[model samples]
Target: MQPLSSVQYQFPLQSLNTFGIAAHAHAYLRVTNTEQLIGVYADAHWRALPRLVLGGGSNVLLTGDFSGLVLHLALEGKQVVGGNETHHFVRAAAGENWHAFVQWTLAQGLGGLENLSLIPGTVGASPIQNIGAYGLEIKDVLHCVTVFDPRDGITRTMNAAACGFAYRDSVFKREAGRDLVILDVTFALPRSWQPNLRYAELAQAVAEQGYAVPTAQQVADTVIAIRRRKLPDPAVIGNAGSFFKNPVVSRAQCAALLERFPALVHHAQPDGSEKLAAGWLIDQCGWKGRNLGAAGVYPKQALVLVNNGGATGAEVVALAQAIQADVMAKYGVALEAEPVFV
Candidate 1:
């Protein structure tokens, strides 16, 4: 087993999370390969301790100093496994940057991921969230997921169907998923690429750009452009992409809300439910560009809550709670946080 002494103590985590909150971990380790990961689990010193498995640290909000072992997966390798002339199979380890992987696939002439460009986080974390943007979701292209089950010291692959994907949710987010660590993810890309412009904003953007039929590259560029205009960059100002999921409500509830606020933005879902824009709800509640202490709602997008510099995790949580309360009182819908709290 690897030496437990290699674990860093009282590690500062301000730079690790996107929120830029001041936090620390009791212990930390960077596992670069499955052997190293196994070594960590085998070590008696760390075996009984509480553990936090983190990826790019984009999808998490650190509430405070954690009294547990923080494991950062850094495993790296990627390849085109096998495919016929019409399709190709691409795979990447957990540590791979998600955007870079998307670009690499585009470089190889693959096109399904164009709409999901510029999303922050790692490849392994993608399947867990079933991350989606523009009009495409990872579930649309994911072929399989390989995970290391620490409980039995076994690694296995689960196909796309078995991943149980939903809108920004999967088996990986449930209780049964805690013991499994994602090792790598495989995607099925089609050689006969098609650009997706299902989202009205995206379709309008492409049309405004004077393209009746945009290529994959053009679609990706448009998506990045839209995101930049709508979301705060984690590098410049600290924030997770979106603070809340769009609230899905029954048709009767949506109609009731529309009666009160005729300008409410909503989308009809396949299941007959209506999805109300969480950002719009927050904005309507006058939370945009507002703050509770140092944590504030992003001016450009009400969906994002930002650290206006020197904000504590508690302050961010406070702002989120305030917004949730106001939105709930006004609209009778509870806003669910998008990021994982640790």
Candidate 2:
């Protein structure tokens, strides 16, 4: 067993999380390999404590000091593992930066991940959140997930279907799979790639940039530019990108809302539902550029809640709740937060 003495107590986490909230964990371990995970799980004392599997810390809100063990996943590696007749298989260790991974794939001439460029977080967290942007989601390209089961102290692989991916959710986020820790992710990039410009804004941006037929690299560059313009860099301003999940409502509910809100922004889902833009709803409620304590809505984008400076987790929660209340009261649609509160 890995000695408990290796763990650091009262470890600072302000720098770990993108939100920049000042917080600490009772015990912290920097996991660089799967053996470390096995060792930790095998230790009875460590197993008894609550655990937080932390990656890039982009999708978490630290409500306060964590009274449990924080396993900081720092494992890193990525490569073009192999290729078949129709696709190229690329695998990345869980802790590799998400945006960097996308860029890396593009550098290797992979195209499928271009539309998901510039998303913040680690590749490991991608499946957990089913992170998406510009109409492309991780699930669209994910081949499989490798995980470590603490209960059995065994490492295993699960195909994409087994992950149970949905919009901003997966089996990993639910109670049944909470104890399974992601070790790495494999993506299957199509060989006969075509640009995905299904999203109107992305298509318009490409046209404006004079790329009648954008290459994968060009699409990634465009995506990076778009994200840079709207979202604040976490290093500059603390925030989790797209603080709320775009609520999915039935077609009838959307039609009634459209009647009441003439300019409501919504998109038709394949399942006959309507995905309402949470940012639009919040902006309509006049929450954009608004502040509640040190937590405030981003001036350029209402979907983002930023830490103006010295914001606490409680303060961010308060601001989020306020926006949710206003949006629900006005549109009768409940907005769910995308970030997990720790």
The deviation in Å at residue 281 for candidate 2 is 0.4
Give per-residue lDDT, candidate 2, residue 106: 84
- The residue-by-residue lDDT of candidate 1 on 8-83, one tens digit each, is 9999989888889899999998888798678778888778888899888888999999998999888888889997
> Alpha carbon lDDT of residue 157, candidate 1?
96
Model 2 CA deviation exceeding 4 Å by range: none
Runs of candidate 1 exceeding 4 Å displacement: 84-86
Against the hidden reference, what TM-scores do the models get?
0.97, 0.98
For model 1, how many clashes? 0
lDDT by residue (1-342, candidate 2, tens digit) is 556666899999999999999999999999998878888999988988999999999999999999989999998999999979999999999999998999888888788998988888999999999999998988999999999999898899999999998999999999878889999999999999999999999999999999988999999899989999999999999998999999999999999999999899999999999999999999999999999999999999999999999999999999999999999899999999999999
